[model samples]
Target: MKSYLAAAVQMTSKPDLEENLATASDLVELAVRRGAAFVTLPENFSFLGQETEKVKQASEIAHKSEKFLKTMAQRYQITIVGGGFPIPVGDGKVSNTALMIGKNGEELARYEKVHLFDVNLPDGNTYQESETVKAGVSLPPISISPELGKIGLSVCYDVRFPELYRQLSKQGAEVLLIPAAFTAYTGKDHWQVLLKARAIENTAYVIAPAQTGNHYARRTSHGHAMIIDPWGLILSDAGEDPGLALAEINPSRLEQVRRQMPVLNHRVFG
Candidate 1:
């Protein structure tokens, strides 16, 4: 039970909810066919619209609210990380949330993004997630399976924070799930490097599913969905396409790396 198959679903989602879900379903089935026990979708796997207000309008509540996610999870019969969705929170603000679903379609955990992407890139591309998306207060990781080990969940922008991954690794997470919809401006420069850094420093496996290519008007995303081992080796990469990347995760590798490096035990912040 030391080895398990995992996958990341890359997509360029559109503004339509039904169309997005249909595409996601097809991708999940493809992952399953490729023998992935756990599959994760990219951020905004549900919808990537032209306007921020459109996202708010499409937001749905989590509890007994979003039928699309649950239906897909059960239908797939695999642990589906439903990427990040817009959930209505009261007062015109919504949470940029990620949902973890079990094989039986039960909700395992939900992590609302803490660090919102609020930057003005050099290409005159600017994003203000805080304009419509509200930040989450709690930080909780989800356990995929006993064999796969506990997985900490984080959205696109949260990858820039090392402290969060450190905390997750310290709390017994062997894998970190990063579902992103990164802009081409930033992803090309920092995506792979940052992902490898997190895996190396934290001594944990990192699976990142990304939105690639252009979606909607004047919006482009960098897509290179990948799965990296604990030793900073990239096992599989989707390479700028709408597809899946599969990797066999070895839990014992985490222990082996931790034993050799022992960095987690040597940390002391003054």
Candidate 2:
């Protein structure tokens, strides 16, 4: 089908896993009620702890864990893009991974975040994602359905890399899913602009679900969950709040944009 409802869920997750899952479940239910076939959650939707060591300690193996993801997906009966979670990677360090679960609660694809957020903002806000998380070496995009088209999966920090989006578009991604827990400082400055740029330059729909508000230990996040079309038009946006934003994905529009711009065909660089 050319028309499909997509949702971006904004959450303010806390350190408590149970509470976080509850909040996520409520939002997912709300989105499904709004007729969204595919719903995306924000990064660290299960746990947004302040300490890296705490997150590492809470990391779970995706295959074995019967926790938040498995239960949520099955209960919702909708394609749920579980936001970035701390997953054990066999090494001492855990990988910040995003899980895509189908309607039947089966794991569809797993995209580990390749680019880690390592920045020292001038506001004395310093983050070293590499401190407790390991980087992913491979760049593999996931396809939900041939009709829905291929989607390039990315986490919070990966939004900064334009090359990744270009590569994904080159690899035939019509839509890019970015689930992030961006800091308020950076999100206000770069969130919408970067998302729109990615959509405009790649000629692809950008689906970004963000974590908003403060979580545990005074950790604050910028929450502006949005869905943008291929022509750089924002279909829907959830401002700084805990809610859901719905938009219809039109393949015809995407085709029109690509046909008009043809940037995907004009690319010559690596």
Give the TM-scores of the predictions, in the order they appear: 0.94, 0.94
Candidate 1 residue pairs in clash (backbone atoms < 3 Å): none
Local accuracy of candidate 2 as per-residue lDDT tens digits, 1-270: 357899999999887676777788888888989988888988888778865544555554343333566676787777778878888766566777888877787878888899998899877888888887889988856675854668789998888999888788888888899899999988889999999999999999999999999886546898989999998899999998899878998999998999999988887775
TM-score, predicted candidate 2 vs. hidden true structure: 0.94
Candidate 1 Cα misplacement greater than 4 A, ranges: 60-65
Clashing pairs in 2: none
Per-residue error for 142 in candidate 2, Å, reads 2.5
Number of the top-ranking candidate, with lDDT as the measure? 1
Global fold similarity of model 1 (TM-score): 0.94
Overall lDDT per candidate, in order of appearance: 0.84, 0.83
What is the Cα-based lDDT of residue 79 in candidate 2?
76
Tens digits of per-residue lDDT, candidate 1, 1-270, equal: 368899999998987777877888888889888988888988988888855645555544233225766776787777778778888877777888898888787888889899998899999988888988889877757675665578999999999998888888878788999999999999999999999999999888999999999898778999999999888999999998899989998867777998998887888971
